[model samples]
Target: MSSLKKDVCNPYFSHIYIEKDVLKHPVTKKILSLFPNAQSLVINHYKDIFCRKNQNFSLQKQTPGLILARKHDNLVYEGAPVCQNFGNQHFYYTSSVMNCIYDCEYCYLKGMYPSANIVIFVNLEEIFKEVKGILARHPVYLCVSYDTDLLALEQVLGYTKEWIRFTAEHRDLTIEIRTKSANKKVLDEVRPDKNVVFAWTLSPEKITVDFEKHTPAFEERLSCIQAAVKKGFQVRLCFDPLIYCRDWKEQYRNMFQRVFSCIRADEIKDVSLGVFRIPQDYLKRMRKQAPASAVLQFPYENDKGVYHYHKDLTEEMISFSYELVRKKLPMEKIFLWEKTKEEK
Candidate 1:
């Protein structure tokens, strides 16, 4: 069985939920064709299943259902305050999918949604239409894979390929598809376009093994990053949500050495740095789901509505990682997320 199949309790997507409105949509049909063995049910709306109360997020993750639905309104949204804008004035993000395949302990999705099932919005053309409208007014830097790892599900959904093709036609639209996926086959399948950036979020091997459950190992992710750079794809390396640990400095230093050794610093588009921070309400939900997670149980300081590591520690982590990266790449290529101060 495939690694992904092994990660889940049952075969991948044993049960599929289809919103009745999109049952006849071509995108839905294509997905259904790929999973003929999957038992699917048609429902009036995706929320009926996705937002239902009292769903056990952890239990359902082992055998998570797939939901095919149409996104009606608010196809594009201004970037969230917690997210790094990377100096883009017209930054925005759109979620073609609702949840992720990998269940990282530090993930905000656990608190953002009520269910663990993956939801794929089958209406890409509608989303593209909205993006074009924004591009007409000013250049748009959009994050297409914000809510889910689109590249990880590329074989099943093929949304990443579609986004690459769409980007080729629009000079003013630059889209970033961030993922922890180590699927190198995607590099061969999709042609590289300058307007499309493939951002990989990497962590230390220890963190990958302990906290980032079911994600690619540190070496696997690094290998994929090398593959992406060789294919001439615009690659961005994200060290964001930097997990705090007793030996984080040693781990991060070693990771930086391995990364720069495999690929030249000039080849990278840019690097981003951030310590773990999540909305307060999301952390509350996460604690309820995984009460024993060390990463979750940490006494994080509440900066406004966001919970994160203490200020001194957060600065120390980012500065240490930033200095290591600066040795290889110029300061212009580094983007770090910092906290804003408010009267206490």
Candidate 2:
């Protein structure tokens, strides 16, 4: 392991809960070796701890524990309506890990999951089998880093490389791995694959520092994006969930100039834009956990079951970003998230 990996493996978890069935699994064993000092406890299933009622999600987030288990069913899911399909007919996502290491105040995981602790499924073959079954029918655009940032945890988990290798074998399978990680070591070690798209989420420096706790600074993430583009990787830029603030326009304007300055917009595969929105239930849970958070506490309008900024504000943000990106790339390459007429 590299010095950076060795250092990160030590501090994240003090206790690890392993499923009895996967205690002997290679992935589980390898993960255990990285944190020899952490106490290990065997459990029947991940949900025994992860789904427990009254788990202080906020408190556990401060120093979350780890759960290693085997996922037997529902390994892959149809992409949610809120997610951008990018014009793919058969879009799906799988979660090898659940809950994120970085705690963004606007993150829906806080409300979608009962616990803040991280869960890493040790069985990749099962997930691969499920994907293969789906691919047998038709082409697939799979988002591997759906629920978690796989590249950020690459040092400890090494699943990102495995997904890339798997994609290389299956011509019909195209995967998108989204991340805010600044870990350039991953890009350096892994070979680039055209079938695999590396999507980096970019936020203005002010919003990143204020709401995205424990994440790499904006400059660091920008540097990683540059490295990926230079290495022949299919890169996609995501400016989604555009947070609303008095100075949002200025921040996003400066961010666009800074990004296109370093990496040519034509070099990337595409760019995605969406305003910050969440399920109504999720916003309720998040508000409870972080009552003082301006991001969470804002009085957003309810459109059906989702909470979002008013329609006018949403349009202003997306349109502003679209025009800026249109200056650099053709209209075909820019994607915007809009509700269907039925949905509206």
Candidate 3:
């Protein structure tokens, strides 16, 4: 165990929660190796700890635990109305991992999950088989990392690499691994695939520092995207969930300038744009978690079951963003969020 002492547990989690059923999984073993310094406790199921009642979400978020278990049910789900389907025939997302390392004030995970601890499904082969079974009948468009920043955990999990290889073998499967991580080592470890789209969510430096706690800086994230473009990867930029802040226009304008300064606009596969929006229930839960956060206090109109900027501001924000990026990339390559026909 002396050599194990040298293993620094990702510096994010204080403990590793391992389900008794997955204790021997190779992926679980690999994850344990990375967090050798962390306390390991055995449990019958991940939800036993992950879904415990009265867990303090905010406090747990400061020192989240890592839970390794097998995903028994609901391996995949249809992409929600809040997400961009990218005109795919069959769009779906999987929560192979739950929760994230970063603590963004606007994150919806706090509302979706009962705990802030991260849960990783150790059974990769089962997920692959399930995906393959679906692909046998129809071409599938899957979002592999919607619920968590899988790429940020790539150093330990390596599931992103597995997905990359899986997609390379299955010609009919297309995947989007959306992330805000600046870790570029994973980029060099796997072969770039045309079927895989690497999407990075960008935020203004001020917003990032203020609302997005413990995430990579704007410059760092840009460097990683530049590296990906240079390596011939299908890199996509997601300005989705764009938060409104003081001097947002000037800040976003500078952000756009900084983004194009590193890579040619033509090199980007596509750009997605959307202003901040969340389900009404999720906003209610988030409000309870962080009462003082100005983001939660914003006068977001409750339209149907969703809470978002009022109609006029929503139009102005999206239109202003489109006009700004229009200078760098062709309008054809831009994807805008379409509101529900009746705002229902």
Clash totals for all models, in order? 0, 0, 0
What lDDT tens digits, residue by residue, belong to model 3 across residues 194-260?
9999999998888889888889998899999999998889999999888888788898888888888
Residue 241, candidate 3: C-alpha displacement in angstroms: 1.0
TM-score of each: 0.95, 0.95, 0.94
lDDT of 1 by residue, 123-157 (tens): 99999999999999999999999999999999899
| Residue 68 shift from truth in candidate 3, angstroms | 1.0
In model 2, pairs of residues that clash are: none
The CA lDDT at 104 in model 1 is: 90
Q: Tell me the lDDT of model 1 at 317.
A: 88
Q: Which stretches of candidate 2 lie over 4 Å from their true place?
A: 1-11, 340-344
